[model samples]
Target chain A: MTTIKVNGEVNIQPNLAEFEFKEVLSSDPSRKAVFLLLNNKTTGKAAILVADKNPFVEDGSVINEWIKDAKLRNLAQNDIYGSYELLMPEKFNAVKSSLIYPATDKHILKYRRREVYMIYETADDYKSITKPSIKESLFNLDWVYNFLDHKAETDRIVFDDPDPNIGFMLAPDLKWNGVDVDNLYLQAIVVRRDIMSVRELTGEHIPLLENVRKQVRRVVKEKYGLNPNQIKMYFHYQPSYPHLHIHVINIKYEAPGAGMTCIFLDEAIDNLKIWPDFYQRATLPFVGKEGDVLLNKFREAKRLNEE
Target chain B: MTTIKVNGEVNIQPNLAEFEFKEVLSSDPSRKAVFLLLNNKTTGKAAILVADKNPFVEDGSVINEWIKDAKLRNLAQNDIYGSYELLMPEKFNAVKSSLIYPATDKHILKYRRREVYMIYETADDYKSITKPSIKESLFNLDWVYNFLDHKAETDRIVFDDPDPNIGFMLAPDLKWNGVDVDNLYLQAIVVRRDIMSVRELTGEHIPLLENVRKQVRRVVKEKYGLNPNQIKMYFHYQPSYPHLHIHVINIKYEAPGAGMTCIFLDEAIDNLKIWPDFYQRATLPFVGKEGDVLLNKFREAKRLNEE
Candidate 1:
């Protein structure tokens, strides 16, 4: 084992073994990291050492293909799907000498690229710019229809509500790996096909909304042992698919698109109750990612307050 | 100079000089990081090298007291306040060899601890729980008053509106280092003292809100060359301070409390227009962090559906 030593000028010398393991601060099984608090034996100075599993790289030449001395423990098996904990040979560990490290240029670029725009979508803009752009070809709902018809992912469905008007089918979202309970994520696909998005909802749809919320809370509690308050239910404005669906996630899970893009189900219900024509008349604001067609449409229409 | 080499089994051997500098992918002056795309001369494989400045550690013994070959670049200077870029010698660099890495237990714990709870606050809950708890002892507004009176941060103030009823003072938030224009952040503190938060806003405050919005946009455009659409104006539901201050930020900046805790100024205006008593009667949902007194109050009142 190669040992690293630090001098008064904080120079890295490669001969002396200085670190003596004191205690483990934290451990993450998923990330495969253990933060160990160590004391320098010679100088008696405390230091934090992060021992993490190295991630796979895109370069094929750097990776070793052989899986030597492999051991597998079955975690769960359902139908053809099986989850296992694999123990392999010669796993490389990346050690971070300390937590205090300057962020990389890639990190800054990533942050810079995450520039979000809030589009103040008026009713006219929705009709002229949004509605026309969302052509049927934009999203392929054949798979969604197939799933609703029980022709796909039949085994994965947690519960199905057959009522066509005031019902939805609950299923684990693809994002959830079905392993971590703290980061539980589920989706409720409505039975009705008429409502394209939250923009289409009215006071008449209150029952449907309430029913979905109630059923979701009940099933989540019964199945996952998660209380109603422990989970958040919301809808995406520019949802990935045209089909109306509600995202039900554990409160602990801070999913992407939760900020400016999400509208709470409870807020929707209350708004509808307050005004029957709330969705129709209200100038809604939603985030548009860079280079989105809808955003381009807004730009072309001169809807954005840009110079 | 120390060199690292990798073999078929990916062992970290510290003798061979294998990497050759190819190109610089990105650079962040603020983070002091440079991402260099390198090619292994011996193996003819490409790799990403993140050259980052080592951060200051808490342990005093590990730090060097001497500063050699130091240089300073004055970026800006204003009335007893100045900003400079410091260049110091013998700065250590931390290198990350690969992007793929296993998350550690500390990362999981940190993510898990960010569990946000949304409280469905009613008028009764506000009166009985929220209002009574904020007994003026919670937040000391003396510094704010001092600033408003031109006794503090007077040099930092961008502009001031003296009208007590429909006026505010715009200043850069302390959180903004004032170096990065992309992550520009400013605060608009209302002149009037009666209004506590968004909850107090009715149709009467439309002028105040609109004035703040307009002035913020105009000043930002004139001074920073940022268009109206490139910035966002919002209010924190359970604000850090009771004073009714609006947060103005660049679209690229994603502040910590921007999610469920934030209420857009436009939304507030729209809601107030829709119903004069919208804030008064509405079941406002705001996020409460873990161990917050308000969260505890909600728990005691059994407002949360936790078991």
Candidate 2:
């Protein structure tokens, strides 16, 4: 819409030329996360403003940022947890958007921010920062495509042919020790068939997990050409993948996150038998490394106190 | 210690004749359910006055219940769901000498009991009510005795013989169908050798659950004289037993709690392989019939919304 002023002074109404659009991304009923993409016209920079809807929208601090891209709909993450990318590049014209009167209708702009996921440093480098999960961001994972793109995730897989029910794969992980280590197969992962990750599991999904030892043994004996007795499986608490996966390793090799960190799948199944929502109900205890943003998220949520 | 007064205005101040004792029941760093056995000299009725340290020592709420024969710690449930047997025999005096207070100091006690477990009803009725597991009332199971008692629980076992790792047995249970059903072996249970129940399990206990299918197959072949595929194993959520047992029933039988209510043992093991605290973490969701004390506890805690 265009408006012209009768006097020499140009009169611009609030909604004039203020275009906006909205889309539901990775939604599943409630949300796993919600975010905003804001481009500054003055500094010529953008930020993937991921947060609980409270901060991103209602709290108005995000509104205070004077971000003009709120109406632009073409921005998306390079991948889950990766920095955002805007498809149509443009120089924003919202420098006056925050200063415009009628208060709530206008944004309060701030430039030069820190501690956020910034992508325009360059296009190719996708730095990942997991979006905080909120009611609006419940992720509806596109598993079929993941199976297509990362399906070669099965490349490191051995022995048994891959089935949608299960996948036995060598993790793109470091060896617990040097190549000189005795047990090379000591670190591998097993993924769930029907669901993406552990968080999605209900008691109903437990059966798919049953008899894990025998199934793994079949894979070990048939696929790896190894003795079934030597293999053991493990699932680390607060695992790295967003998917529900298991690690199968040689019993002889002592790997990191082993022993107590390792929960026998059988025990987990039995526990679920007694309490189906065990994963959801259990207060997870985990250690954070130096640059762990997850720990920061936990600290922000008061789930864990920061040191 | 005894307080003697000659005239009517007797000086029975503070610790004149206060008597007290302590009992250590299921205890950890923060809690131990302690109680006093008191006897009403006039009524000749006894009660197990149970409460926390304060109610037992300083406050006299627990002492007022007047229980008899507390050293007769041999009290047990008429049924696992019923009350303790302290009511059966009723002549008690403070047997233990704590030497703390003067001896039976004062009675600032009133008795109008709205909540308690009572057992005088009968024994043939095996009412099944799970206990509410508050932090103060965590179970301390006695396993060695269950082994001694239920060790022969393995004798009725058919189709499968006991392995050091796995043990199988037929339970003395009624058919799922009323009087019409046959094939009782469809409801057999497999008990783990080491731990009492799922709560005691850690990663180390997992191997005992491994190759369960193979063991089950061996049983189906040898003990049942049937094909391996005919049998299936189920572990009910919030099962009544203190021991870790798996139900190895015929797969064709449509037992109650089968699909979602029951967790397949195999799935349990697999889940544990990922996160060991599966059972401990899962919030148990169950329906309790009226008169079930545990549900009453949940109601008290507001875990489930009131009807």
Candidate 3:
């Protein structure tokens, strides 16, 4: 394998992908970077989706047809939960995709999930209910990962369901949902066994989250001792997650991205059921704080014009 | 005023702001650039909300009380609309704001509006009941100014309220709402007399938009021969414009940024009515495509952390 690096100042069009990937590597690194060698996918293309990330263009549009490859990597059981939703040049072959707001079901291949196949198993034989949310077969977060991670752990946990399939851990830490989670009485973040975001959502993954709403409802009503109407279970569009989790908060509480950036799990599920094409047929909205990669993809695609 | 130019490969942190402004100037020119002079607003700060025009940061979170001056410009009536929402350093003092996804009213200074004190009157006085949709006002789409400047000659105008207080221009452009407008239906782009975005929506602007829904309902019913439900009015989060405009489209149409990037006019109106602090109280979520400035502001503010 050859590693190609483009350094120094260069005009955008010819060196666009290399220039962008260098920046992408600096800010985001969940996926490996793809190099443009002589026989590379984007060798002659003026505009190409260099990696499976968002659309990174040299200018207004493209000049050539490009190919992409999976920057493959190996994962341990601990990382089995991460959303490997990286797009490859090959993905477009499976579907008719658009850089402009994913226009059709054919564009569904845009939501690429990293290859995840392992089922993690902890050293100890997993118990049924030491805690409902803790799945013994999942990645264990440590203090080393983040010095402030302990702050989240110290806060009260409303509920924990220990099933590996529907495994989850609950925390009423103010960090998950919004800033006023404690003050406004908004709610907690319900972390799952996996560490991923909504981009990984698909028909196959839909069934995995099947009981999330039901389980959350039952526990909130009986275990947490709260009224069902006031409790709300939702997901932030571009949620900040070390691990993929859900937010269960009170409806009366108003917080960051609450209405705009979030969607009710019930609403998401209903949307899925009504439109069988759900993930593919419907338009999945994402909020990038402004200069984010995903949002840039839309801009480069010309779907969203930046003024 | 001193103009600072940055060129070639250099370590950031040192010449960060100048470096950033160079790139900003390269892509978006609607907003002026601010250099971090020794006594600059970002002199000692790591990250700063330099100036809001969608691009937010120079690098990291901020420090120091920054000062801003308006980069004045000359405007011709022909060059009516354009990106006039860049927040100068001076705007923050007038408003209370937050960076938690545009949460507090503090960040409210970001939505800067150009001083549009004049009303454009077409040569014909904007006759009523001409056409439902016009191609002119949709995206005038000039690299610089808004072409809706020529109101009368090109298309049909249903209503052009001369009062700048209730300043709104209505045109039924099938393009304003969705792609297949002829068969599926009705539309309008309610151009506000002033240059601003939804984030600039204060109580004062509400009165201007008051009769819009009522007027559209009546006209689409009487003139266009369409049901009021078929006539839709909405707002794009990041609309293409020189001034703020409302998208009045049909409900039957399936289009881009439907759920994620749009808010219904009625919903915005109700939200303002129910909560007088409307813009101040709620969190404003933005979709950031790679290299966007405002989204960068959030990242610099630490509201959006890259993991």
- Candidate 3 residue-wise lDDT, B66-183, digit = tens: 1112121211111111111111242221111111111123222233221111111111211211011122236454422242454343354556654445646666554454234433
List model 2 lDDT by residue over A143-207, tens digit each. Answer: 43354346545453344324445444444244534233235443334444444445445687675
**DockQ computed for model 3 against the true two-chain complex using alpha carbons:** 0.02
Q: TM-score of each candidate?
A: 0.65, 0.28, 0.31
Docking class for candidate 2 = incorrect
Evaluated on chain A only, model 3 obtains a TM-score of: 0.42
For model 2, residues B102-218, the per-residue Cα lDDT tens digits are 123232122221221111111111122232242234555454235334654444434443555565544435443222222334333444435544545556667766655566556
Candidate 1 residue pairs that clash? A27-B105, A28-B105, A31-B102, A31-B103, A33-B104, A55-B100
- For every prediction, compared with the true complex, DockQ reads 0.08, 0.01, 0.02
Among all windows of 10 consecutive residues in model 1 chain A, the one with the lowest summed lDDT is A92-101
Q: Where does candidate 3 stray beyond 4 Å?
A: A1-307, B1-153, B156-158, B172-192
Where does candidate 3 chain B have its weakest 10-residue lDDT segment? B114-123
* Per-residue lDDT of model 1, residues A28-112, tens digit only: 3223344445556666655443434333332323322211233334443333222334333332212223221122334223333
